[model samples]
Target: MTGTPRLDDPHAFIRAHTALMAPPMVPEVELHLAVETVAIWEQTEEALGEMGLPPPFWAFAWAGGQALARYCLDNPAIVSGLRVLDFAAGGAVSGIAAMKAGAATVEACELDAFAIAAIETNAQANGVALTTRLGDLVGTDDGWDVVLAGDVFYEAEPARLIGGWLETLNARGATVLIGDPGRSFLPQDRLERLAEYTVPVTRDLEDREVRQAKVWKYR
Candidate 1:
């Protein structure tokens, strides 16, 4: 339990390291999430033997994602019959919510291999179908009708790149939605608020029990 986990079978690794549960804000759909944040981060770092690897963001249901998923569940009409892209989808929470809300199709895109496996597992657990895309999809347009991005504006550089790309997508008439808990780099001036939620979160991950999360549409 102290050493690196074998990642040859990412599915098995995810199943062994996480539990199936519902996020607090969106209980209608279940996800495979890590019970302990630090433990999973340490384990993944050890397994990869690299300190530069990103933290296990996919292992937890972030406040922003929870809020976004809740909005999708409450207002199904927004996504019904539209092709959606869950950009930088961590655990595919919003994507699963969209599918349950009657979306025509959902593609959950992530760069982490473990995230890809977790997305597939979470999709199946909720009995929702999601297409998993593994890579950096920035600066690319796939002609999706609706694009959902949750908790993606945490850092400066990535936020800059993704924000510009999202603006481009919005200009092209694709409905781009962003969910965020007021992260440091969120482009507030370029977004129009759609909805807000008081999302529950774990202190180990967010340093608080609740967060004021908002869903925004690019304007």
Candidate 2:
């Protein structure tokens, strides 16, 4: 489903290695999370060999996504009966939350094969239906009623592209929302704050046990 090289028995590998759990902030949505970060990283490297593997981002519920899911669940009216897009969807937590909150349709996009598998497996585990697309659709105006992106502004160029794209989408009347844990690349000046949360996270992965994440609406 992604441009990343396909792994042999990817779904089985994820099922064998991860544990089904819910993010602390959004207990209503379940995800297959890595029990330990290091092991999954090593396994992906070994499995992919010379080509190596992308970081197993899908194996964790990032602080931003957790907070966004909590907000969506708490305010279902934002997504009820609407078509939703989850961009750069890792674990698909936001997409799944939108579905659970009564979205008419949910779609997710990712460029990592492992993440694609995780998204599908996690969606099935939660009994939610989702449509997934590979690669970035940053420039496309797909006419979604709502667009969700979480924990994505951690890079220089990508954050800039997404910030500009969100503005374009917002101008077209789409409700664009972004979730971030104050990553260095986040374009704070371009967004309006919506909500905030103290989210639990894997210490080893995030360098802390909890993070101050925020939800922002693209204005």
Which one wins on TM-score? 1
Report lDDT per candidate: 0.89, 0.87
**Model 2 misplaced regions, further than 4 Å:** 1-6, 49-52
Across 28-110, the per-residue lDDT of candidate 2 in tens digits comes to 98899988788877776676555555778888899888878888999999999999999989999999999999999999999
Q: Which runs of model 1 end up more than 4 angstroms from their true locations? A: 2-5, 50-53
Relative to the true structure, candidate 2 reaches a TM of: 0.93
Please give, for residues 1-219, the per-residue lDDT of candidate 1 as tens digits: 544346677788788888899999888989888888888878876775563446678889988888888989899998999999999899999999999999999999998888898899999898889999999999999899999999999989999999999999999999889999989999999889999999889888789989999999977
Model 2: how far residue 105 lies from native, Å: 0.4
